[model samples]
Target: MRAMARALPSLLLRLLLTSTPGALGTNPGLVARITDKGLEYVAREGSVVLQRELLRITLPDFTGDFKIKPFGRGHFEFHSLSIHSCELRGSALTPLPGQGLSLTISDSFIRVQGEWKVRKAFVLLSPAADSKTRIQARLHGSFDVQVKGITISVNLVLGREPSGRPTVTAPGCSSHIRDVEVDISGDLGWLLNLFHNKIESRFRRVLESKICEMLQNSVTSDLQPYLQTLPVKTKIDSFAGIDYSLMEAPRATAQMLDVMFKGEIFNRDHYSPVSFLAPVMSLPEQYNRMVYFAISDYVFNTASMVYHEAGFLNFSITDDMVPPGSNIRLTTKSFRPFVPRLARLYPNMNLELQGAMASAPFLNFSPGNLSLTPLMEIEAFVLLPSSAKEPVFQLVVATNISAMLTFNTSKITGFLKPGKIQVELKESKVGVFNVELLEALLNYYILNTLYPKVNGKLAEGFPLPLLKDIRLYDPVLEIHKDFLFLGTNLQYVRA
Candidate 1:
């Protein structure tokens, strides 16, 4: 056995990981007890946040429900028992402070089912809306509950706000996200009513708001000012969801985003781009729902895809002069280097990623939950040479791509000689190269400014960058996804 261990490669060693307490694939359901306990449910449903942990959860009953074990029948449910990252984070016993809670999770699964109900109780929220306040959360919720092996199902309820209050509630909140409602007892002005207060220092709140506000300003001032009117011109746009309303200002929101260049940039004149409909769908249905309902802070009413820069990628271009319109397939078999973009969207608190990110400004604070690897995306664009007669090149869409690629020809009208291709992104620390990094790097190629001398001409061959060039961009081999997005300037090269 010892000699066999000696022959093992480092990859196996990493997979071995630190010896956790449990046996290999132990059923968490085995740890359940008959005592009361505190439970915090952090679940997302499409886009709503639900925070109400019910009573009990035990695998003693229920059919088709897979319990904490896979090899076994693995079917169970619980209440007043919230589970986080598999193990119990914390819980609030209803009516009475409960004791031990049931915590079960399957690492391979994306959703957890639950059944639950609540008795009489009142949850008073003292939202510290002071300018210096921020809101933090400690919750307990249950998807379902059980009493003596029977499922006690309950419908999620949302009571009407008092008639006098102007509740600005938007639809589509993420389900798994638990939003805390703050009820201020005193009268306050509009400006002062903007935020909730946490126990953190006063300066902390100011800093966060100030930073987000400053970012808002920087977008408007810097990136948007220089964009010209037509390769279909418009200077102002958004990046990383930050609005940069530069030049002859367009409306502030997507509802108002009129395609002014419509009938003009047609058919062959269009800049055909195959982009990702990439939904940040991995988020727990609860959190996804919570983001939809309760998380205005995480999203915005004026959300627009003004622009998104992805990279700081270090993936080496193995072959020089990759043929144009040719897809560089990175399958788990051919290219084990590719990472998935799913995990980068709804990052969990843990999970260290390694690879590259174009920009990773706030990654240190919170790593998003979007994590998946061995995935594929389709992002292709063309740079039309600036001649009265447009160039017609055959685009052979490559097969064997890892993921689905959707194209809406209307959104990206034809591209004429673009002066400079501006890609704004941040760098990743390799937390999950899995993809967000590669996705970021691809920006340098997709509709990017072709070699200025290449002068917006679509190169006839593949445009893969030399592997060495990838390294110079401050590649991150280990880090999270949120902070990855960097700014890049790439001139088209026909290599």
Candidate 2:
């Protein structure tokens, strides 16, 4: 008994997951939950700033091989025998190709103070340092430079390999640098300053090539691996689980990044066959960041199939269900109990109620009348004392179900209500007596037992997928021709 109790949830879970028409094989369903067709991830300026890592660079030593003779007095050859480098402190960046960015560096300077030699022609140099000859050359200044022509792009892919994670790939890109200017105050400012324009131009070309290379390498090599793997499954106790899968890679635009994915809220042990209807992405820009998803009939049908196979459609009315003051009616024609009450007259009689889905649920997403209808088969049987396992009397009824959808805050909620009820007497069997009033009892059982259960399960709608360190708010739903849209704003909070 204890072992059965422990295994009950697992059994229920296994039944909840079956197979769809297209997905009937092993490990069928997609592994990720897709919201708004996929993950419509938009990292604004704030997110970019918070996540940007620091950068550092080291330059090789420079050698001055040429000689400089000012006013034909004496010849001076300056040489740098040590290493020199500069650091780019911080940067402000924008998206898209051919955009502009600004970089600033404090305490930035280049110094090449070393030995110098001066040779005179007939010793006619006016200012000659023959006793002690030294070369003092230094150019130190803070820089506020602008870079342009930068282009960035990312391609996101999802799968389950070493782990269930999405991967991003970025190709190598380049840009041109212009408007390079630097201030200088050093000993060689007078003679060395002659080539200021030439120096700036050379630096611009080197800086542009270096920055582009760094950006491409970092995005493709470092950032790609970090974003490739993500935890996409949610655990709902030991019986149920919610899964998410990416339908395709994410595409980037001028303003935002768009991702496509699909999601499932079903049992852990059972699999439901589902067809993905890709939704159009028109992420409304009413908030800083938002996501939208369109719920389709496929999702509803998949949920229903999983529920049907989980044994939730079948129920029983035991002998203990008799009212305290009144006995259960033995005859189905009217509410008339047999003489001497049911315990003595029909001691071993019990009622068995069973329900099955005749067809998949139909979802119509019209303007105001977004309704879901499903057809089902319901059966009732009376177990006599002689036939302990089999039924003596049975009745089959067909029921038409209608459920209305409404919004409960960010989640979509549904209300279950039974519609037309059709009694199928051909498939129904009657033995000892015929009860005309059994139809009403069957209808009551369906509305109170089956339909409400379905509705309540649906009312516990799928929650919105969330990002790390971000709070989502005001999730809104919109219905379109191909798919449904779920939009919500994102707010970043400090942890």
Leading candidate by lDDT: 2
* Candidate 1 lDDT over residue span 439-473, tens digit each: 33344443242223122221221111111111112
User: What is the lDDT for 264 in model 2?
Assistant: 55
| Candidate 2: worst-modelled 10 consecutive residues by lDDT | 97-106
What local lDDT score does residue 141 receive in model 1, on the 0 to 100 scale? 28
- Candidate 1 displacement at residue 79 in angstroms: 51
Off by over 4 Å in 1: 1-393, 398-495
- Scored by TM-score, the top model is 2
Q: What is candidate 1's TM-score against the reference?
A: 0.14
Stretches of candidate 2 exceeding 4 Å from the true structure: 1-43, 54-167, 185-194, 221-291, 319-348, 356-368, 375-387, 397-400, 404-452, 463-476, 480-483, 487-495
What lDDT does the true structure give each of the candidates?
A: 0.22, 0.45
> How well does each candidate superpose onto the true structure, as a TM-score?
0.14, 0.59
Candidate 2 per-residue lDDT over residues 143-221, each given as its tens digit: 2223332222232222233333456433434445435554333444444445446545655665555555655566566
